[model samples]
Target chain A: MRMRFDKELEMLNGEIEKMGNLITTAIETSVKALVNQDMTLVRIVNALEMEIDEMEKTIEQHCMTLLVQQQPVASDLRLIEAALKLITDMERIGDNAEDIAEITKFFGNKTFINKLVHIPQMAEATISMVKRSVTAFVTKDKELALQVCYDDDIVDNLFLTVKNYLIDLIRQDVNNGEQAIDLLMIAKYFERIGDHAQNIAEWVIFAVTGEHMNTDNIGKTK
Target chain B: MRMRFDKELEMLNGEIEKMGNLITTAIETSVKALVNQDMTLVRIVNALEMEIDEMEKTIEQHCMTLLVQQQPVASDLRLIEAALKLITDMERIGDNAEDIAEITKFFGNKTFINKLVHIPQMAEATISMVKRSVTAFVTKDKELALQVCYDDDIVDNLFLTVKNYLIDLIRQDVNNGEQAIDLLMIAKYFERIGDHAQNIAEWVIFAVTGEHMNTDNIGKTK
Candidate 1:
């Protein structure tokens, strides 16, 4: 029975890792789609989002079943709880990616609104945070999880840079206002995705140390 | 043992309902603050947000303990799972409200943005959805849950109205761009709050009927 429980636990870990990979791919694809104005990549991100949803529900059911069948205590319980929370964050990341894709579709064929430098950089940092945070969970690496939390600052700073740049663009020419607002919203979405990734990392920390990272002001924007 | 489980389930129900009320108040106050330009109410909304966060963590711990100690199965398992998911949505509602308050603070003492009609209406609809969705859960009323899902359409429609109005205002004069975008964002946040409430209602339906509401495209903007 103990062996069977251990095997099932291993399976749960595998499922979450798979979901994490799908989410990171979706985020990366969404940003690439926006920067390049590529509809095909946007479609792919949407498709990836649907798959992520299915994976989220599947992992959720699997975790519940484990809780019921095994009645896991101590670290086992924490692992299952963390898995449940992590998937929700993963699903939100997918949703935010889809949001970015939707906005990209809205901007279809529109002229470039300044070179998309900081936005892409922000997306890369957020995607890395997503990947490493999940790896921290799968490997029980607390340091990696903490590092993911720290990287959120980079995403946040880039968001401010994007905001200020867009504001300047809007001020210079009122015609740029619409696209500037759209770009600002896109940056905000990426920032939110970063927060969700940080939330996953916090849960990873919780799973490892039995203490939730201080997330009191987590979603607040500067 | 069965009676004890029933009692604990009732306690869980009560806890979630309480959280739901606090969330709705926060939503309402944030909107009122925005409409009236009242800093006092904004502060109140922020304070309520902190309490809502505390309640979320406490109830989450309680649910985890219930799961670990009782090992509830079948319908009871569904109830606990639904409650767990509900609080996450509820906590998000609080966060979104706090976000609205933050934006309201940003817009302090600003002049009128087209009389603030539909945004308030959207807030009202969202607060009702939040309240009724939780009531549906507490009563195990699938119809009410379905109704909450239907009501989301009203909020979505109001969002479009708000968006169009802001667009027209921005087009009329370039100087209105900043406040117009801010108002649009506030409307977007309320739309998001409504989505979160509808999500809670969907979980209610799931608890009662063992099927998640078809939320495949939920949170997608038109």
Candidate 2:
């Protein structure tokens, strides 16, 4: 019975890992589409978001089933709960990615806005954070979870840089207002993605160490 | 044993209802602060957000305990799972309110760029939606849940009206850009709060009927 329970737990972990991959792909493709103005990529990101949402529901139902049938105790219970929380964040990441793609569609063939510097960097940093946080959860690595939490600072800083740069762009010419707003919104979405990633890391920590960290500042635009 | 389990379930429901009241208060105060530029109210909203977050963790722990200790089956399991999902949406409502209050702080005594019309309406609509959704969960009323889901369209429509109005404001005066963007962000937050409320209503439906509704379009701006 114990062996069977362990196998079920492993399967749950594998499922979450798969969902994490979908989230990363959404993040990567959304930003790539923005930079290259690739409509096809935008459609792919949108479709991936639907898949991610479906996966979230599937994994949630699976987690609920495990809890009902096995009545997991202690560490096992925490693992299921943590997965439950992590998937919510992962789904939000997918939503953020789709939102970015939506904003990209608004650009409407406008030429590149200020070379798209910090925005892509923010996306890259955020995607890595999502990847590492999921890995930490699967491995139960407290250290990696902590690293993901700390690494949130990088994404936060990048967001500030993007905000200031966009502000300057608008100041230089108010004619840049519409595109600048769109770009800022996109940057904010990436920052939110970073925040959801930090949330996943914190849940990972809670699952492993049973210590709840204050995450109030995780995604705040400080 | 069954009587004890039922009693415990009632207690859990009461705790969630308490949490729901806190969420409603947060929503009310945050919008009041935004319109009135009340810094004190802003502080109140922030503190309430913290309390809401704590309640989420407490309720989550309590639910997990109930599940593990009692090993509830079938309907009971579904109820607890739905509560788990509801609290998350509730907590996000708190966060969105806090975010609105945060944007209020940045406004810092600035006069309104335009008359506040749809925003306050959106707030009222969303607050009612939040209240009715929670009540629906407590009563297991599918009609109320469906009502809340339908009401989300009202909030979504108001958001679009606010967006277009703000865009026109920015277009008329370049000086209006910053405040316009801030207002837009606040409107977006309210829109998101409505989305969270719709999510709660959907969970209520799921809990009562075991039927999942497609909610991706709930709070989306058309």
Candidate 3:
């Protein structure tokens, strides 16, 4: 029975890793679509999002079945519980990526108000955070998970830079107002993606040590 | 053993309801702060958010204890699982409300911006949705839960109205650009609160009917 439970746990990890990959692809494709102004890439992001959503349902059912049949105990129970919470954050990362794509659609081939510098940087930081958070979960590497939490500062700093840059653009020329606002929203979406990644990393800590990180300070900084 | 499980389940329900009430207050106080330009209300919202966060940790511990001690089966198991999911959504509702209050702080005693009409309306609809969603979860009322899902449309339409109003304001006077973007972000936060409420109602349905709602269509509309 122990062997069977271990095998099932391995399968669960694989499924979660696959979901993480899909989320990474979605974030990357969405940002690429934005920088390139490519509608085709936008369609790809939407499709990836739908696939990610379906994977969430599948993984959830798997966890529920394992709980009912295996009746995991102690650390095993914590692992399954953390998986449930982690999937929700992963799913939101996909949603935020889709939101970015939707805003990119609105840009409609117009020249960006400024070269897309900070926004892409924010995306890179979030995507790396997402990948590392998932890896930490699969490997149960608490140090890597903590590292993911630390990486959030990079994304947050980029967000402030983007916000200030947009504010300056709006102040310099009223004509830049609409696009500046759109870009700000996109940057905000990336920042949210970072937050979700941080949440996932925190959950990993909980699963490993049975102590949830203090997330009360999450939005307080903003 | 069955009787003990039932008693613990009742406690779980009560804690969830309390968390729900905290979320409602946060939402109401945040909106009031925005409309009244009252920093005092913003402070209240912030305090309420921290309390709500503490409540989440406490309730989560309770759920973990119940699951480990009783090993509930069938419907009881479903109820506990739903509780776990519900609190996450409830916590996010509090976070979004606090976000709105934070933006209100940015307004900083500025004079009226077009009388603040639809934003207050959005707040009202979202508060109702949050309240009804929690009530449905505690009472196991599928009809009321479904009604909460339907009410999301009201919030969505109000968001579009708020968006257009802000766009027009920015068009008429470039001076309105910064405030308009800030106001737009506030409206978006309310919309997110509505989304979280809808997610809670859907989970309530999942607890009652063994079938998860198709959330695939969620961000597709936007």
Candidate 4:
């Protein structure tokens, strides 16, 4: 019975990792679509988002079944509970990527208002945070999860830089107003992605240590 | 044993309702601060958010304990699981409200931004949605929960109206760029609050019917 439970736990972890990979790919493809104005990649992001949503439901069912069938205790229970919460955050990351793609559709073929510097950097930061948070969860690396939490600062700073730059662009010419607002929204989405990643990492900590860190300010944006 | 489980479930339901009330008040206060430029109200929103966060942790602990201590089956398990998920949406509604209040701090006694018509309307719609969603969860009213889902369209339409108005404001005067962006962010936050409320309502539906409904696109903003 113990061996069977362990096997099911491993399967659950594998499914979660698969979901994480889908989310990472979605974020990457969406950002690539935004920077290149690639509608094809945008379509891919949308498909990936649907897949992520399905995976969330599937994994949620798996967790529920495990809880009902097997009397998991202590760390096992923590892992299952954390998986439930983590999938919600993962699904949101996918949605955020899809939202970026949605906004990118409005960009058309026009040249960007400025060089695509900080937005791509912000994407990279969030992607790294997402990837590492999931890795920390699967490996139960509490230190790596802690690192993911601190790395949020990089994404937050990049978001601030992007915001101030777009604000300046809007101030420079009223013509830049619409595109600038769009860019600001995109940056905000990436910042939110970073927050979700941090939430996943914090959940990892909770799963491993039974302590939920300072999550009160997880999604609170500056 | 069954009686004990039901009693615990009732306690959990009461706590969730309390959390919902905090979220509702936060939304109302945040919007009031935005419309009135009331910094005192913003401070109040912040305090309410902290309280909401504490209640989330407390409720979460309650849910986890109930899961471990009781052998809930069928609808009982569904209700517990749904409660676990509903608190997340409630917490996010609180965060979004606080975020709206955060932006309101920058408004700083500015004069009428074109009479603030649709924004207050959006706030009203979302507050109603939040209230009804929570009541739906507590009372297990699937019809009311479904109504909350349909009401999201009202908030979404109001958001578009507010977005278009702010864009026009920015186009008309470059000076309106900063405040217009801030106002747009506030509207987006309310829109997000509506999304979270819809999520809670959907979870209530799931608790009642075991069907997740059309949540595949819950947070997918257009």
> Total clashing residue pairs per candidate?
0, 0, 0, 0
lDDT tens digits by residue: candidate 3, A5-80: 9999999999999999999999999999999999999999999999998999899878877776777777898899
lDDT of 4 by residue, A23-95 (tens): 9999999999999999999999999999999999999889878877786888999999999899999999999
Report lDDT (Cα) of residue B184, candidate 1. Answer: 79
The residue-level lDDT of candidate 2 at B186 comes to: 87
* TM-score to true structure, per model: 0.93, 0.93, 0.92, 0.93
For all the predictions, what are the DockQ values?
Answer: 0.51, 0.47, 0.41, 0.58
Q: After superposition, how far is residue B53 of candidate 3 from its true place, in Å?
A: 1.7
lDDT per residue for candidate 2 within B1-222, as digits (tens), equals: 899998988888899899999999999999899889999999999999999999999999988888777877778888998998889889989999999998899888989998888889999999999999999999999899988888888888888788778767766777787778778888888888888888898998888888778766655556
On lDDT, the stronger of 2 and 3 is 3
Tell me how candidate 2 scores on lDDT.
Answer: 0.87
After superposition on all C-alphas, the RMSD of every candidate to the true structure, in Å, is: 2.5, 2.3, 2.6, 2.7
**Global lDDT of model 4:** 0.89
The segments of candidate 2 whose C-alpha lies over 4 angstroms from its true place after superposition are A217-222, B218-222
Off by over 4 Å in 1: A216-222, B112-114, B216-222
DockQ of 4: 0.58
Model 1, residue A83: displacement in angstroms?
Answer: 1.0
Per-residue CA lDDT of model 3 for B1-222, tens digit only, reads: 888877887888899989999999999999989999999999999999999989998997787677666667777777878888889999999999999998889888998668999999999999999999999999999999888888888898898889878877877787787788888889999999999999999989889987779543544455
- Give stretches of model 3 more than 4 Å off: A215-222, B215-222
- Top of the candidates by DockQ: 4
User: What's the chain B TM-score of candidate 2?
Assistant: 0.96
For candidate 1, lDDT tens digit of each residue in A56-89?
A: 9999999988887788888888999999988988
lDDT of 3 at A31: 96
